[model samples]
Target: MAKLLLCSLAWFTFPSFADNKPLNSPVDYLSVLLSLVVVIAMVFMLGYLMRRFNVTQHGGGQMKVVGSMALGTRERILVIQVGEEQHMLGVTAQNINHLARLETPLEVPQASGDNFKNKLSQLMQGHKGKTDE
Candidate 1:
């Protein structure tokens, strides 16, 4: 047992006596570190760009259920609106049954000759009323 322990200790320490040369040159290590940093920076930059462009907004709010069209006998397409954006999502009969409990409009109303300027004016008026209140 003593011999075995000594042999094991020697085996562990033997590598420490060998030449301590780094596997990669200093320049190579620096290049690798720089590449890693650049990759991380690029990833963060891409994320920032996506956020700036509002590319990640989805599926949250007083969603307007546009339609529930049949896909199969059991599955259907569920079209929903989040803010001004619309999304058509696939849903099963289970989801359709669940959706039936919610106060979804039978039909979304079309703009009654109201243009962008009128909408903007209405929004501004609403904002002014809120501020006054």
Candidate 2:
């Protein structure tokens, strides 16, 4: 047991021998900083790409979120449109429960369906037409 304990203790104390080497090297620090920056930049880049694509998506898919309401911090009600039918669902932290299937599907707002790109293109077209005149 003492041999095992000494062996474990010796393993833990190997870093103490590293006192011969400097604790902080500028090159090491800079490389770590650059690596962190690159990882963060990649994350932001991927997020931007996903957001850009998602924003340009048109509405009126076969399955769509018709509406949603927050009941609490971790609970909410969601109305999803599948084909021609709408389903009401209760969402909680644990699980999702289907409340009912609505006979009439609720209307999805015009704004939710229209993304910024479509609106911007329409605005540019109007501007171009005005300039042509």
| Stretches of model 1 off by over 4 angstroms after superposition | 1-22, 58-133
Model 1, span 1-133: residue lDDT tens: 6469545644444433245544355665665456557657877998999888657664335776666678688888776766655666768856533342324434555433446668889999999999998
Compare the candidates by lDDT and give the number of the best one.
Answer: 2
Which lDDT values do the candidates have, in the order given? 0.61, 0.75
Candidate RMSDs in Å, in order, are 18.6, 12.8
* Per-candidate TM-score against the hidden true structure: 0.29, 0.57
lDDT of 2 at 19: 49
Candidate no. 1 TM-score: 0.29
Question: In candidate 2, which residue ranges exceed 4 Å CA deviation?
Answer: 1-28, 44-62, 109-114
Clashing residue pairs, candidate 1? none
**lDDT by residue for model 2 (1-133), tens:** 6469545644444343344544366665565456557657877997899897676665656878888999999999999888878899999999999999998778866553356678889999999999999
- Name the lDDT value of residue 101 in candidate 2: 92
